[model samples]
Each structure stands twice: as structure tokens, then as C-alpha cells.
Target: PSEYFKGMLSRVGYAIFFIPFFITYVGHGFFSPGWLLCPGFYLLFLIGLSLPTALLNKKLVGTSLVFTGLLSGVIVFYQVNKLSWLSWHKPQRQILQIIEDVGTSQTKTLQIFDCMAAEKNATSIYRVVGYSSSIQEIFWLNHKVLPEIQILPCSEAGRSVASLTPNIIKLRWSFPEFTVLTH
Candidate 1:
């Protein structure tokens, strides 16, 4: 079990070393609720795989620390300098494209998420996708500007539900025609 623990730690030690985690979550607006669980199971799996080989040689034990340390240093370097390789230009273009695709300049009912984990957030306007139970249920929301809204069950409820932690508002799959606001 000791070797298993160390081996698992070693793999995490490497992933922690790589992955520009800060950029993906904060800058790009990415969110997955159970993301932390991925590593927990992966840790167990790594132990099962690595222990056999590590037990045969004592040197792999030392290697884990070295890999961990080396990656840590690199990650810190990128963060401190504010040097992210992601293209900021790409997202702006995408947002414009979405607007063009949605058409009619609808009054987007924007929802806010606690993306920064901060209190007292502000409202962000979004093109209304319509009131639905899920992603596919786009009916009145499609054509209407600021159409009738539905509070998703799995999401935060009530009016302030928009200010909680979600990027896209779930619309009902059965919705049909919608109104658009004139500029």
C-alpha cells in the first residue's frame, strides 16, 4: 500500500506539474462539477499500474520527486509572468459568430455564474435561448427577445438563479416560435 500511495502521488505530482489549470477555468469559462473526481480514480489506477514496476526498482521512488519538482517550477514560471499561450483573439470572433447566427438582435437574457468565486456579482446579458427543461428544448426562446424564462431544475432557482454559477441557461427542448427585440 505504501508503494501504491507513493506511485499515485507521483502521477498527480506530474499532472499538477503540467496543465495550465488556471487559464482553462478562469479565462475560457470552462466548468465541470465532478472534475476533481477524475484524479481520485486515476490515482488509484496509477498505483495499480505503477506499483509493480516501482517495487522492482528503488530508483523510481526518487524520480517522482524530481519530476514533481521540475514541473512545479515550470508552472510557476508561466503563471508569474502572465504568459498564457491561448489565443485571446479566438473567443471574440466566436462570440460575434454566435450573435450573427442567432440573428434579429434579440434582447439576450444573460445569466451570471460565480465564476470568480466572488460575492456581489453583476448580471451578464445573454441571447435568450428560451424556457426549457434542457439544452434541446428551444421553443419561444428562439425568436423572441427576452422570452419567457424557465428555471432549470438542476440549476439555481428563482430570479437570482442567473447570478449563481452557470454559463449557459438550459432551455426546454419542446419550445417553438419566439419574439425578437428590435434595436
Candidate 2:
């Protein structure tokens, strides 16, 4: 292949490689592991389609191999950073410690409101994702399961607090902000 053709091909390859990353960022406003599914499949399809052309030209094959290596490196780097960030489950651990300190026997019911809200809002990228049972699962994993623990949304916290029994301990926690109230 001519030098000009090779240069143009390399530039096009680079552009194609970054298309998925750009799409993911635009769609989610950040890069999320979950959001990569569609883009990943699209990239795979493109690769499959390019296989015939790559096999026909030795230079194209070599260029593709280099591009694949670069792609792998970028993926590995992103995953490592994401894993490190996700490992910081400080709020979960702190909540578990508080529960342990209170002694599960003394507290009949535990209510957690605004859970992880502060963290979710503060994070610029990869916001904390959770379901209704996330707190329960976290507590269960820590082996400090409470007999009755209610994970309430911030909106329902006031109503929940009003209906709280004398035996229930209300924990209004929004990650960095934690308050324990005994009724």
C-alpha cells in the first residue's frame, strides 16, 4: 500500500475505534460498564465485517492487530480504574459498623432513608447504581442482618418517621450525612 493510503486508513481506524466511546459518553453523560453493551456489539459487528478486507491485505491485517492491542489496553485501563473506585464502599461499611455498635438485639426495627443519595449526586462519573434491595443485600453480605430493616426513599422518609413505633430506630443517612434517631 502507498504511504498516503496507509496514513488515511490508520486515521479512519482510529476514528472508528473512538466512535463507541463517544456514543457511550453522549448517551449516559459518562462512561458506564452497563452502557457499553450496545456499542460493544456494534464494534464486534464492524470487526466481523472488516475481517474479509483485513485477510485480503497483509498491511491491513497488521494495522488491525495494532489497533486491537491499543483497544485492549484502553479497556484494561478503564476497568482497573472503575474497579478501584467501586471498591470504596466506605458508606456501606460505616452503616454496618453503626448497626453493630447499636447491637441488633436492642434495636427492634432499623429504617434507612436517603441512602447513598449524597454519593450519587456528588459523583461526576459512574454514579452509584442501586435497587430497592441494595441496602438489604449489603447488610446481608456483612452478616449483620437486622430482623426488620426498611430502606425508605427520601420522599417517604417524613411519613415513615411519623409512623415509626417506639421500638423502631430511624436512621436518616445520605452517605456522608448520617443521623440516628430513637423514638
Candidate 3:
């Protein structure tokens, strides 16, 4: 790359590094997996910039190789076992399983109370950017169209359930815990 091109790339790298901060200021403070791409690009930029210097010293080359190998190993391990380590994934999966178990042909709609509230209070890392609704997160995770699921506030649960038909299933959600209500 020419000097101008290298300078432009460096500037781009700095811009990429500050993306999360800009996003946080402009939008909801939710960090999603897509934000990771920025850091990945910055890492590549750094590695590319340092490659020439690293190649000049045999010891530095060896150290860089070792570090790269270690980083690769850690990344592979995380990818392989991410489901177990990601705290929110298990509960989300379990919630889906529960819904699957209880859902049937006769079930027309599924209503979850306090879901939005729970999501707002949640400290989960796996949040969908720009949405504070667990319903969106669930949809993103499953990538499937769920039954007509409505998220209602806890205060409206009684009123909503009272007006519900027999075909609708009501569920009370308090973060990791779920209660299926039988009418």
C-alpha cells in the first residue's frame, strides 16, 4: 500500500474502533454480535501494520507465531463451547423448549407477561440492537416464526388474561423463570 493508502487505512481503523461509542450515543446502549466485526477489522489492521516489523526479528516472529496460535486456539475453543459459556443462551433455549412442549395445534396464541420488563432489566450480552423486547431476541435466536405471541406488562396480565379466549396460552416470565398459566 502507498503511504496515503496506509494513512487512510489507519484513519479507518481509528473510526472502526470508535464505532461502538458512536452507536451507544446515537442509539440504545445495546451491544450485539455485529459490533464484534468492528474489533475484528481493527485487529486485522493492527496485525497488518505490525507484520513488517515482526518479520525483521526472528525472536519477534516466533513470539508473534506463538501468540497467534494461542489466540486462534482460544477463539476456536470459545466458538466450540460458546453455548455452555454464554449465560443467556441456555435460558433462552429452555424457554423455547418449554414453549414447544406446551404449544399444540389448538393453541392459537401465546401471551408472555412481564417479558419486556424482564428484558429491560436483563444484563444479558446477547441482546438484539435497537429492541428491548425478548420476543425479538427469541425470534432472532430461533429464526422461526413463532405462534402469535404477545408480550404484556405484569400490571395488564389480569386484564389481558380475563379477555383471552380458550385457545390462547398465558405464560408469566420473570427472567430465567417461567410459569405457564392454565385457565
- Scored by lDDT, the top model is 2
For all predicted structures, in order, the TM-scores are 0.27, 0.44, 0.51
Give candidate 1's error at residue 105 in angstroms: 13
Where does model 3 exceed 4 Å of error?
A: 1-29, 33-37, 53-85, 115-147, 161-165
Candidate 2 lDDT, tens digit per residue, 1-183?
364355444445545666665654674454455455445545555554445564546677668756875775578568647545454476556665765566445556667676544446443211432433665555455556645667676787788777867767777765443577553
Ranked by lDDT from best down, the candidates are 2, 3, 1
Clashing pairs in 3: none
Backbone clashes counted, model 2: 0
Cα error of candidate 3 at position 176, Å: 1.9
Give the winner by TM-score. Answer: 3
TM-score of 2: 0.44
lDDT of 3 by residue, 92-160 (tens): 665667655653556656677765454355333224111225554554455454456676677878887
Kindly report which residue pairs in candidate 2 clash with one another: none
Full-model lDDT for every candidate: 0.37, 0.57, 0.56
